[model samples]
Target: MTPAKTQFSLPDDFNPETLMVAKVTEFGVFHEVRRAAHLAADLVANGAPADLDLAEQILAQVLDRQEHDPADPHHGNFYWMREDEFVEDLNAVEFVLEALIPMMIRHAARLTPALQERLLAAIKLGLMEVARLDVLVAYTNIAALGVLNTCLGGELLQTPEIATRGFGKLLAWIDYTNRSGHPLEYNSPTYTAVTLRSLKLLTDLTADAPTRQAARALTARLGLSAALHIHSGTGRWAGPHGRAYQPTIVCETAPEVERLRAWLTDGTLPRWLASFVDRPMASFSIQETAERSRGIALTTHQTPTFALGVASQSFHPQANVLMLHYARPNAPRPGVLYSRYLLDDKWFGDAYHATDRTKMLNLPDEGRFLGVQEVNRAIGLYAQIGADHFASAKGVLIWTGRDEIDEIWVGEECITELPHRLDVDQAVVVARR
Candidate 1:
């Protein structure tokens, strides 16, 4: 049977160049954040992020007295804990909480007033925590405030303290650059793009000229326009390990678009473009091996055969089982074969030594063999490998014909029911020529 057709929606004003830029930038930031979380967790665990003498000094002063106490009952004793253990867990929690703060605030206006107030309190607490640790809260925090401002309309902006703190943070990120030991690691092109967007939003909300100029200056300095062009077109970024980094899409906004446009036209593209080129690919196959002796004879041509065709191969090296398709040449076949290798001579000799009913049932090799779940997994693996290899071979089986059967197909019902079988455990591949 033929597959059903799929449909997709397109934007009214779709431009490939603009869309590409937006997509790359958005994805880049997402990738950076994910990487940062992992990196931060590792660094914290190693006692690196909090090991800095200056940052620790600042943290010591900023934390409450209870936090520093060796035996405070209410403080949870988290601050006084060993740096290695505490930092890793704390950094992970902080990363998640920091990320959630902006996300919660962004969706706050759509929620009930109680939820909005709760989210605001959460954001404030998160901000204080991150600031106390000297961690920079950038575009995410700025965007969260933008959402809150939009929701609250003019009332919240009327407060000078709120306005000053929000605008100040936004401006600081705009001018932010890597300096001293504090690395200005912009997560992705998208992050910078989003920051530009937040600045635009701030300018729109308060008509702040200085913030607008700062945003423009940041765009010029970062060469965001050129970066966007390169990223959207053919440019690539490589990580420290010489692996190409592919960004994931997350945020798409007007400011991001503008920044991308500017990056393409301007000459400030980053040097990491060389890392995005094509790489290599690999594939694998399987074969059957056996031993022939007088009474221990086991050949594929032998009659009363308890053998079957090979089903699937695994991508990983440690995986041992192979799925078998039990469909006959013309009959409406319903069964599947799960062949397992007998590692021990004692088990094989005792199990298949005789066809006695009682003996066969009691044999460990026969009874404790392949399970149903394994048989199903093998079938699924067969389908996956088949499809991938089929496409790779340009719709033709490359290794089949003369002496080797390169490809095979199975019925839909057999594949579906293979998983639900109760008798079989892990499936194994055996020769059945």
Candidate 2:
């Protein structure tokens, strides 16, 4: 049944007409439509006539689910999941295009006439929705991706108006980034990867010279920002991430690093940026600062053996404020030190567990102040007033390699437990390895 459900196989007893009903009707139906879309595209590209027919059927079913009501907010978008009939996924319209646009570009001639007409209409609808949403420049990843969707859709549909809007947004984003000294979602491992993919798509698909040039320059700048944070000894993204999940050592195999390497090798980036990526591991040390936005500042210090990163303040759900990563000989990854607040006994903003945002509290500007006094400062302190915010002032968390660290001290007391709550108003934390 369903060919034993290989990674991309459709469900057994699946019918193009009733798949959605069956999914909702059944208790644990397990089909991944996104993977199926990619699979269908692959089959259409290279499979036999029977396979091509099967691919078309899958694509047709997917297309039927797009919301088509002119008055609906999700007019051109698909549900985040098939069972979701009412909710709208804001990012779905462009992301679905990521799979669909390339198919039209490469295999439009092969598709049957009816399928081609339907596909063309769907792309146009999605493009119009993207223009209506008009994501702001500050929301970096989606804004970059929206630009690509509109520009590419315009090119595909021979609609100059859509292309013009896309280009205007692109220029505005460039201006905002230039003024801010960094992308608004700066140094994010997860989102930077998404932005890189979108930038690459714009450079590859759009014929507009100015848009292509702008995308290339932005790609190069983001690449350099990443290269500076990569610790030579540990081969990890040295932190103070504007947005990141729980993982401490995001490595070379990560999507962002892979994309950065691809951009660096193309020979279009500046020589210095490329050279730094190719540079040998040696006694290197440097401090970098960026005016993150109007009021916040980010500073990072990286050496061959260790790295320390701090943000003056942040509001991101997973902001990595005051992070330290150090080398550990023969270990798979680096030793780590980072801060996490405790809210109602749960780690604040813990990505692993679903936490309630309403009950959780954020630090006030005066309370959230964090910094490293000097470039190589080993001892650092984070001040937070817990009276206003219901969360407790939990001190730093540490993960050490074999023999990397024997003890940690918060003020004068040796910390015996992890994530110790410092009782005083100001606590100085130190990690000794």
Best by TM-score: 2
148, model 1: CA deviation in Å? 12
The lDDT of each candidate is 0.28, 0.66
Query: Where in model 2 is the C-alpha error above 4 Å?
Result: 1-39, 42-51, 248-259, 262-272, 282-293, 348-369, 378-405, 409-433
Structure candidate 2, residue pairs in collision = none
What TM-score number comes out for model 2?
A: 0.78
lDDT of 2 by residue, 1-433 (tens): 4243223345555545633223322134433344456556766676566667877887776686688888887788765455456434577777777667767777888789999999899989888778888888988888988888877778888888988888888889888887777776778777787787788778877888998998888877777887776666666676777776554333324423344456666643445675666557765444444444446566777777887877766556467766777776765656776665444355333222211112223221223445553676644455555456564444445444425567767667887766465565756455555
Where in model 1 is the C-alpha error above 4 Å? 1-109, 136-159, 162-183, 186-209, 223-433
TM-score of each: 0.29, 0.78
- Model 1: per-residue lDDT, tens digit, 289-341? 11111111111110111112221222221112222222224422212232223
Judge candidate 1 against the unseen true structure and give its global Cα lDDT, from 0 to 1: 0.28
